[model samples]
Target: MFRVSLLFLILGFTCLSCKSEDKNNVGTTEENIDALLQARYTKLLNYDVDSTAFPRSYSPEKKQIKQVPSKDWTSGFFAGNLWQIYKLTGDSRFKQRAKQWTAFLEKEKFNGRTHDMGFKVFCSFGNGLSVEDNQNFKDVIVKSAKTLSTRFNENIGSIRSWDFGKDRWQFPVIIDNMMNLELLFEATKISGDSSFHKIAVKHANTTLKNHFRPDGSTWHVLDYDTISGQVRGRVTHQGINDDSSWARGQGWAINGYTMAYRYTKDKKYLDRATATADYFIHHKNLPEDGIPYWDFSHPDIPNVSRDVSAGAIVASGLVELYKYTKNDTYLNYSKKVVNSLKTEHYILPKDLEVPFILDHSFGDWSKRHEMDEPIVYGDYYFLQTLLRLKEID
Candidate 1:
C-alpha cells in the first residue's frame, strides 16, 4: 500500500504530460504549486459538505472522504490551508472560503480538554489574523491560549498532552505539545500578559531538558510525576517502538523551538532546533528526495511508507530557521523538500476528486491507520512551506 495504485500512477503521469512544455514559462515551482492549489480547492468549495464535518483525509481503500467534528485536532487545518493559499496568491475566493470554513471552528476556543489549541485555533484563526486584521480573530486567539493554559500544571512545568489513556499514562506529555506554545506566545504579545509567555518558556525549557536524547532524536511521550515534578517514564506511542524516533515528532520539535527562539531570542531554543533539524535531514535512513519514513528506526527501512506530512512540516520549520541563521544548509534542505513535493510523484493526481493537494502522508503507525493517504494536514503544511519559501525568495 506504500505505492500509489497503478491507476493513480497513470493519472499522475497523464497530468504531468498535460502541463506546458517549458516549466519556467508557467511559473516558479512554488507558483505552480499555488496554481494547483487554486484549482483543487476551488473544486473542493463546490462540494456540498456537512456543516458540522471537517475534511481529515482521503481513504483510498474505501474510496470515502474521512471527516471529523470541529473539536478534532485536525479540524482547523483545512481552513488554515485555505487561508495560507489566499495569503500566497491574493485570491479573494480562497479568502472568502477560508472565512466560511474558519467560522465553524470558533467554538473550539473554549474546548480546553485538548492541548491542540494552537493546531486548531492558531492554525485557523491565527492564520486568518495574519492575513487580515480582525479584532474578533485576535480575541479568539487570546481566549484559546487561556483555555490551553488551564492544562498546564505548575509542578510539572509542561502542558498535559492527552486526557485519554489515563490507565496507561499518568500526566503524560507528548513532544507534539511543544507546537501549541505559539498560541501562548502570541497571546502574551496581543494581551500584554506575560503569564502566557512565562508558561510557554517553562514548558520549552522543561522539554529541552527532558524530551531529547543525546543523538538529538526525541521521544514521542513523557509521563511526569505530578507530586515530585519529575519524569516518570519516557516512551513512544507512534514510533516503531519505545526507543525509535517518530519522523513527525522531530519535525514538531524543530518547528516549535524555532518559534520559541523567535519569541524569546534564546540561543538554547535555536540550538535545539538546529540540532534536531540536522538530525532529521542527515539521518542515514532519510531518502535522497528529503521525505522521511514514518519512523526513522522502522525495521522495514526503504520498504516503509514515506510521510510527506513530515517533510512539509520540517521544510516550513527550516524556512523559519533559515531566516534566523542565514544558513544555506537549512534553506537547501527545505528547497529539496519543496521541489520533491511539487513533483507528480507526491502531488495528488489531477483527475483525483479528493480535496487534498498531496498524497502519501502516514498518520498513526501504531494503529495502522491513514497509511499512504492524502491527509489535510499534509496539504496545510505543504502550502505553508510554499508561502514561506515565497516570502524568503
Candidate 2:
C-alpha cells in the first residue's frame, strides 16, 4: 500500500516531503547517487522552485522558497541545474524543462545593468550549448558577452561589479567578479573574436595584481576611483572583518583562477589557484570533516555555522586542478570533500525531494540572513562537484 501511495505521489497531483538525515539511509556510491538524484528529480517536478523564476534560497524563517526575477544574479542557476541534470541522465524531460526555463532569460542576453551576465546567461545557456550545440543559445551568449563588455573600461582594466553604493564606491570589483569572466572567455572562443578575451585577461590581471594578500587570502571587494582609474580602498561586504580570510572568497579565488587557466592556459592563473587552495586547505580553522566555517577568521570558532557552498566550489575546482597538475593530492582532497558532503553534516535525507541538496550552509552570517540553511549556489556547486567526480570513471 505504501508503494502504491508512493507511485501516486510521484505523479503531478502529489507534493513530495522532506526527510531528516538521521532516518537511516543507503546509496553512498556515486552510481547509486546518480540514479537516486535522477529518479528524485524526474518524479519530483515543479516543486523545486518557481518554474517561472530562479530559486535563490530557502527562507527557513518564512518556511518558503525564495525566488529572484529573471534579471537577478541567481536566475541562471535553476536552469543550469536542469541542463546539468539533462546531461547526467539524458532525460528529455529535464532537457525540455531546461529549455523552457532558459527561455525566461532570453531578454537578459542584452540587459547590461548588471555584471553577472556570466552567472545569468552562461551558466544556463553555456551549459546547454555544451551538450546540445544550439546556435540560438550560442548567439545569446555572444550577445550577453557584448552586453557585459559594455561595463568594461579600458582605463579601469576590469568590469564593474556593482551599480549601487555610489556614495561608498566609485568602481567596485569583488573577487566574486572572477566567476563572470568565463562567459567572456567562451564568447571569444566561439565568436573568434579577441575583444572578449582581452577584457577577460585584463580583468584577471587586474584582479591578480590587487585582490590577493601576501598569504593568498583575499579581500572581498576593492573600490577604485572611476575617474583616476586607480584603486581607492578595499572592504569586506559579507566577511567577518576587512582582513579576514572569508571562506567563500578564498574558494572563489581558486575556482575563478582555475577557470581562467582553462581558457588562457596561463601558468600564473593556476599557480594563484594553487596558492589560494593551499592557504584554504591548510588553514587551522578548517574542520576535520573538510567543510569550512563561514569564514576562516570568524572570531567565534566552534560556534559558527559552516559554509558547504565554499566546500563544494573548492572541491569542483580541485578536480580541474587535479587534471592540470596530475596531483593525486588534489584529487584525494576533492574525494574527501565530496565524501564529507555526502555525510550527514551536509547531505539531505534520502527519501526527500527538496530543491536543496545540502544543508547547514551560511547565507550571510553578519546579516543573519538565511544562516545555516540550504543555499541555492551551494546546491549548484555541489552538483558541479558531483559531475566532476563522475569524470574520473
Candidates' lDDT values, in order?
A: 0.86, 0.80
| Model 1: lDDT to the true structure | 0.86
Clashing pairs in 1: none
Q: TM-score for candidate 2, please give it.
A: 0.90
RMSD of 1: 5.6
Query: What digit string (tens of lDDT, one per residue) describes model 2 on residues 248-336?
Result: 88888999999999999999999999999989888889898778999889889989889988988898999999899998877877777
**Candidate 1 — worst ten consecutive residues by lDDT sum?**
8-17
Across residues 95-137, which tens digit of lDDT does each residue of candidate 1 receive? 8888998989999999989999999999999999998899999
- Score candidate 2 by lDDT: 0.80
Model 2: number of backbone collisions = 0
Residue-pair clashes per candidate, as listed? 0, 0
* TM per prediction: 0.91, 0.90
Error of 1 at 260 (Å): 0.5
